[model samples]
Target chain A: MPQELFNKPVTELSGMLARGEVSAVELMRSVAERTRKVEPKVHAFNSLDEEDALAQAAASDARRAAAKASGAEVHALEGIPIGIKDVISVAGQPLTASSRMLATFVSPYDATVTTKLKAAGAICWGRLNLDEFAMGSSTENSAFGVTSNPYDLERVPGGSSGGSAASVAAGEAIASLGSDTGGSIRQPAALCNIVGLKPSYGRVSRYGLIAFASSLDQIGPFARSVDDAATVLGAISGHDRRDSTSLRMEVPDYRRGMDELRKSGRKWRLGIPKEYFGEGLDPEVGAAVQAAIAEYTKLGCEVREVSLPHTKYAVGAYYIIATAECSSNLARFDGVRYGHRSKDATDALDLYFKSRAEGFGPEVKRRIILGTYVLSSGYYDAYYLRAQKVRTLIRRDFLEAYKQVDAIVTPTSPTPAFRKGEKAANPLAMYLNDIYTIGVNLAGLPGISIPCGFTGGGLPIGLQIIGQPFKETELLAVARSYEERNDWRNRFPTL
Target chain B: MPKPEDFNLDHVANLARINLTAEEKTRFSSQLGDVLTYIAQLNEVNVDGVEPTAHAFPVVNVWADDVAEAGLPVEDALRNAPEKRDNMFVVPKVVE
Candidate 1:
């Protein structure tokens, strides 16, 4: 079994494949076996197209062999395996936003992100489960089932990218791609104890990713190492004609930044946001994060108190903007033009009502109602308009704070992964879970959560590094410095 | 803070196009109402005269040209609908 391949970084695996240490088919099976062994406990997949994945792997191997034979340059991602979030499109594969409405639906074409991955020689191993349509904080809203936290089976892995996070955390996949809209990726990364990066909003294309909040959604990587994350981001980051919002600039060589940091002795200025480590945080997790910060200080980096006054308004602004976009984006699924329609209906109105009624889950319905309420004609001036105003203020606050500081720090989550039903009973508690991370998404800056420490219960705590827009390289430098000092990459949950 | 009782479950259900029993409505109303009230605390923030932002960082005119490049064929697009009756998306006729 190539299962030893499971623990290697994606770059190492890619190098092994090129050197014939293991074939693509061999690596694919190794991951498949691991997925089979651990997925029942993790509940990470919405759909696992094993046959397709292996076939793609075989093709990638053939291409690499052919390229090597011909002395031609091979695709950097040859034979690499990636887990796609359910929210991203995978051609000829099911693209259920985890909603029952799209339960049986398959995407006709690949999203721009998928296209890039395929072109770069990576194989899409499976579709990870997510909160239906990327709505909820936990994968509990998944039409299929909730993904249990790998750290503790009965607890939730933070979501709606929970499956993506858990899959990577549990070694189901070497790397998985997830979309972050208001902390979807970072929060789950914290809970699952993986490195999750929310790229600057336009750093990656949003064309193929199902819209959660159009403005905030950005595709990013969840991997075990900072370099692995950088490698995958390099493969997927580029401009696309399909997504107008895709950045026009050339993708920076994020790996090169690592070399620069190494040469410069890895010194970084850390900014600890006084606003973040306030009262509501779990003290154990707070100690872990502060400990991580203290290491940065001891390493010759200055730690200063930075204030982001408007950090308070992020969740509020995010919900309103995200909801309004969701309200508009989801309007197309009115049983008239889409995947699910009511079985029996006397009229069109009844059909629209019954179809949506039966298809959407409680959370989806809740977000839809909230979005509709905010965007509805009469109340738009009050709710939607006001939220937009607050959104601006949130962005300005981040810009203002970044001027005084190089990067802002936060506890990736307020608490460690909680029991499955612990906060399931209350939506507010669930939203509060994302408080530390959402502000970054609201400001459209890049943020990453790397496991810094652990709780007494053994769950991991994440240290967040928030950077100015497109400063992913800098953010990862800080993360890598800490990761090197006290490597959390080798830490594993005893399943 | 947002009003909890003001959200009759009927309004939420109607807006969301969901069928709800009285018990479900009662449960969801309190649940959703609590969620909204917590979220509404942002209003007290003195965002007065401060412009509300729609996207993070700076993005200007990030739209593609309106020219038709290429897209999936309609046949492929319709492949996922659980039910489709015509070239167009067909639903129960409600216009009378």
Candidate 2:
């Protein structure tokens, strides 16, 4: 049986395009048709421009033809379709961060990642929905509307990159880009039963990513396979002069590196952090992760127990630091320059208050208020400063464990996708969804979540692999080892 | 550390430049109190001389060359402005 082009991975699609098996236009139409079929049910995209996507595909076909005629090399991602999270800017596209704040705004310049993707000859697909300002664990916080989990419409897809994950799982996209502040990318990928990678901070440029906890946020990929993720990562992982924080380091050919590592037959030292397996983790999710570890041992890998003592404080520390950064970064959305402007204001001061109150959703307002309180006079040291110091402790904990382990393994999320609105009313409960993944952001390390198995209820379970800083190549290789041995990556939601 | 009960919601809303309805104030005051109480657990960590980490891998003093390059055109720069006049964003009256 022939696989549907819409559901095929990037590696397969790229190969077909190179071999003249399919034109880029046909591939785009297949994906666009799939998106139209599933988007009404999944609501994965905030908006899409299929016409524009087809045009880009036509251009890719032309480029490939020219390359074939001249015997020139074509880029790895040529003719592939990739979705963009709403928070990342794509010039001439709607830049709504799933919020009314920028509901009417359009970007005038491409994000660094967007530019790189286009340069690699990929068609930038749609503006995928997210939690407004990427603040919540579920897409319920989005002002646009909730994006349903492709696996189960009643449950959330996990957020704030929920749509990014759901689209790929539903065959609406071949691959997608998402930004992880806490666990936006990995958590959603876990729930959707896909592969998501959060690159180490500074490893990827954040030039056009809407600031959300700037110190921790990193743009990453969500794909059907680890190999697909490596291809996307290689295109977007280089340093940019526009973003000073981007690391000035050499970008390796991650796909080639994965092959090299596999050929070397090297076994990795895997760490199982005891803190991640404690109370509150769903029993099935724990069993799946543990089974994955056992598989690693069978593959001749060394499995060890390591402790990250400061793990308990990750969520609390994350909220303080992330909110503080958000409150400051979001100040740019005032009515004066861009975003929503108040029609009910009496003066400038009144405009600021009314515009923000009207523009922001409840979660955004709650975070802004909390952030302002923490950074306010007399409370800065007690809250913000204290959290930063605690952050230091969290990073040290990962470093300490890294000395004994090549990579750490844990459940990507505590539970499978929960029913929509289950933890919506309580912010603290929602924040706990990122408990296992947030420490990686604090420690500035790369982490990848790969589908390990499914729950008895048929929901997916993800196994997270934490890698050393600036070591995504090794991380993807480690994740591929399990992926190659498992059939989980082959399954997709029947949308 | 200040008690979570002592959190001044109205004052914080004012600082954040966001208006809250009476209902919102009441709801948020209680909810945020729970979050703050949870955060109070940070005091349990012994950080006698530990330094704070603003960024996990800090890159200090990044300098670009003293050179000129094209920037966003005025038209593009003001493209998203809610209200604009002659390529400048228009805002509410400030001076009397």
Candidate 3:
């Protein structure tokens, strides 16, 4: 595969297709070859349907040719190859969510995002691995195996969108759609050296996404560059009748804001939330983020330190809220209705018991239990209720901080990806990796993570840009400017 | 922080309807204990008068209108089910 294709933004590729400079078949072939080559080392995908992907690409070319001949307005994403996280349902394809329970279960319908991608003429490659039910922060929780960060094979690719992030970074796919609940998308993007966006809760439809935390989960994009990320973002966003929580607000031309920001004489004012720069961040990542902020200073952007007083309690509030929702969403997986059923059981109750026993993994069971425990009648007020109250404060913190600053900058993750299995022993330590990101999700804000620099051992570091709700355009403006100045988007792993 | 022994995995597993073997059960207890111990850190933070939030943004009327939309066709929806006796999801007989 040529590095040119890897470096080209999706918009550029779309133009190439429109001008007959490249055919969809050729583009898909290049990426298909790359996916086969890198996936073994990176462990990025749970399923790879090469025949279907090629067919889809060939179909895209045929459609585009037909449209041009017929003088029809062409959809912008025609012929792009986008990887999808396994959890999202694509009609007639197996959607495992990287879990064994549904290893052989094929989806009966396409998820809202999947249908949108197909309609836009973007070919869907097989599903990518993730933490089971999107629970863990590291892809290590995947039942199959850990997804390695292509940047450094020894370290993790962050999860639960870890595979989605790594695949795009390694040039396996042009972009990917990933779910964000407590920073799953951004944290992984930060660790893998790519652009990952977490749309505000309800900004994008989640009808087809396998539920982890319904209230917090939103499907967003991970691409090699900010512009590519924005293209995919625009394609998948908009209200869907299938998802009740889907927003009906006008979908902005996300790319337009970047132009406005670039041409405007307005000064850049960025807030560095005090709590983000506090105690636990890795020194190297901190330095890299601060340097990135300083570069914005040269761009006529002013930086100021601000405080979000409720930051300390975000993790607690997140786990409580996320787990509580997880418990409810997962209730349907009772081994009877949909997927798994134990081979034999003494009774119906035993069937539900044994089938679920054999189906879900240990970590997933842990969450279900924890969620159930927290939401149980006895503990609801103390744990679940209090977490909800604090969740309000966490949201308020962002509103209050945004009142004083146009956008806020933080380390996408507290530290770079640790070695696989390093934090699994202590789930709390694993959860801590989300400290920098959980609040953004908690507050239903949009955030993006872009590679800023590297660690001492050559791992990637990311700087996060957070914007107020429905402000994805502004978020990308701050991100694209820094990305253009630095050109770190093309950085990739040797693997 | 909570003690390691505070959580009993067996009881939790029973509630979750998972039948873990003795060995698996033993392993889960310690792991669940660690997870709880970590979550216990949140107890120290004070969120007085704070309201618990369910959605990140306020999205009233997330529910679709009561429109009679077309649902999955019976044939297509039943294509994947290994065994179906009628136009519905099927399972082994629950009654003896």
State each model's CA lDDT, in order. Answer: 0.82, 0.94, 0.83
Candidate 1, residues A106-164: lDDT per residue as tens digits?
A: 88889888998999899897899999899878889888989999889988998889999
What lDDT tens digits, residue by residue, belong to model 2 across residues A361-382? 9999999989888999999999
Rank candidates, TM-score, best first.
Answer: 2, 1, 3
Cα lDDT for residue A241, candidate 3: 79
Ranked by DockQ from best down, the candidates are 2, 1, 3
Taking the tens digit of each residue's C-alpha lDDT, what string does model 3 give over A413-473? 9898899878877777888889999999888899999989988888999999999888888
Who wins the lDDT comparison? 2
DockQ of 1: 0.60
For DockQ, the strongest prediction is 2
Question: In model 1, where do residues sit more than 4 Å from their true spots?
Answer: A1-3, B1-5, B57-69, B94-96
| Preferred candidate (DockQ higher): 1 or 2 | 2
Q: RMSD per prediction, one decimal?
A: 2.0, 0.9, 2.1
Interface RMSD of each: 2.3, 0.7, 2.5
Q: Cα deviation in Å at residue B74, candidate 3? A: 2.3
